[model samples]
Target: MLSHLPTNHHLRPLYRLLALASGVYVLVFGIIGVVQTSGAETFDRSGDATALGLPTNPAFAYASVAVGALIVLSALIGRNLDFYVYSVVGLVFQIVGMLALAFLGTDVNYFNFSVATCVVSLVIGLALFTAGLYSRVGARADAH
Candidate 1:
């Protein structure tokens, strides 16, 4: 279905760029998760054990691989408004998750870093979404 779609020349570049950025982010994060969870004995957050109940094992490695695959697929298949929508959703989730992590944090330094990263990610996501919207509008205008 994707192969048969006509090219919107104006939006194609923007879509590809966004897709690449998102895919890279996902892949990197997933890999980090895999490394962190692999044979990680230090349990800094005991709350995670109760809340997420994720076993510190090879399962996380598999999850990372799956995430990496999904990111690649999304980058390849995602285009048009779907890219913008998914980006927004991901940013929102990151913001909320970071806020929750901050609230649960005992250390000021960690909380500060988490909040800062969340803010930066949210800003970037908003900018990307705005660019996507503008690209679509510009394309429509040029077409008309």
Candidate 2:
């Protein structure tokens, strides 16, 4: 069933670049978030902190930095390692986005995520998933 997915796709480089760009974007966002939320409570729910125009808190900002770094590292390491990294991160982003969306404006919004953040997360997740799908490498015999 998974045979339909392309391996060593012609546009793999482009997809990889997009994924890298996404990681960089997230990294920058997290850095700015950390700076913006400095001295604030780790899980502050004041709903007033924001970074790169998205709501955030210390905990979320730190997590973003870690996740972004992981993505960046995996993308740089390539050789199909990125494929697994992107796939897992993509799913994680999707799940986090949904959970944040569901908990918005409530006490459980641990990430202090706003609607914009949720949208961004979902978009990034999709981009990473697509990149992973086309970034696979196969033996010479399986090349198309």
- Candidate 1, which segments miss by more than 4 Å at Cα? 1-11, 41-71, 79-81, 84-91, 94-98, 101-113, 131-143
Q: Against the true structure, what is each candidate's TM-score?
A: 0.49, 0.95
Give the Cα error of residue 48 in candidate 1, in Å.
Answer: 14
Model 2, 1-144: lDDT tens digits are 457778889899999999999999999999998999999999998878888888889999999899999999999999999999998899889998999899997898888888999999999999999998889899877875
List pairs with backbone clashes in candidate 2. Answer: none
lDDT of 1 by residue, 1-144 (tens): 333333355665675566457656545655655565555433333323211222222343344356445545654665454455545545654564466456635653221224444454455455444433433322444445
Q: What lDDT is obtained when candidate 1 is compared to the true structure?
A: 0.47
lDDT of 2 at 77: 94
What value of lDDT does candidate 2 attain over all alpha carbons? Answer: 0.91
